[model samples]
Target: EDKVVQSPLSLVVHEGDTVTLNCSYEVTNFRSLLWYKQEKKAPTFLFMLTSSGIEKKSGRLSSILDKKELSSILNITATQTGDSAIYLCAVAAQGGSEKLVFGKGTKLTVNP
Candidate 1:
């Protein structure tokens, strides 16, 4: 079975602080790894990593994949209270039906 694990299940930070979240996975014929941020309801897509060592960035958020290690990392800079949310990591495997297997997620709380 494919599995994803996220480190530091939860974190507390003040406004303007930077945070790093880690995710590792094990799956057969891995296709990609995706990151999502969840707030009130559904999760919002963050990044999708397929090739190793290429970092994907959007504003203060960025992510990179390490295929050799079967892992990925998400970095958030200058985090604000508005950035408080659950960060989810999912992996897509190459198979008949494309499905994403998600991790429990890392809960981040950015205080004012």
Candidate 2:
């Protein structure tokens, strides 16, 4: 199945460390970019950047999309242990036809 993969697989950070989670994908007829934060429960939508919304930010988390490059990046600043979780990246086709193809996710661990 076409999919995405994140590097490092996991990360460790202190109470106030900046981190960058990477996501690389390979899907059919790429559509848009999606980012979610997974913490025990299902992932919660963090950002959805289509051709219309290519960049998004909320507090300490921010992300950008590059359709031409066929990749995206997510950045987090002053991360805390509460920020600890698996960050997931997904790709969905236009018109929302197929399921959201997901990456293996990057597990982030924050230490106090």
Candidate 3:
């Protein structure tokens, strides 16, 4: 199960101030999360967060950089579990605007 939560759904701010609105979640089969910033016309994509790692997976849906091919994939893996934790994303969009979407999946298979 996976869910995205935006704390303090509402807030008040002043000019020349720095604020951090938080979005937290707990996912069993966590894969990817996208952040959107909407002003008026349809919302635009801000960024994508995957359980895999930024954009560094390769081979089996892993992200890797090929200096020769001059290309890369966002499905690579090489990390530590202790260094694992969901990234907290926050954005300030128009009132009653913006949303947090949840997604999951990858090329990881665990077998005995």
- What CA RMSD would you report for each candidate? 0.6, 2.0, 17.4
In model 2, which runs have C-alpha deviations exceeding 4 angstroms? Answer: 94-97
Model 2 C-alpha lDDT versus the unseen true structure: 0.85
TM-score winner between candidates 1 and 2? 1
lDDT of 2 by residue, 1-112 (tens): 5778777699998989999888877777777879999999989999987774356889999998877667788999998989999999998865447788888899999999
How many residue pairs collide in each prediction? 0, 0, 14
Candidate 1 vs candidate 3: the lDDT winner is: 1
Residue 30 of candidate 1: its Cα lDDT? 98
Q: Give the least accurate 10-residue stretch of model 3, judged by summed lDDT.
A: 103-112
TM-score rank order: 1, 2, 3
Best by TM-score: 1
Candidate 2 least-lDDT 10 residues: 48-57
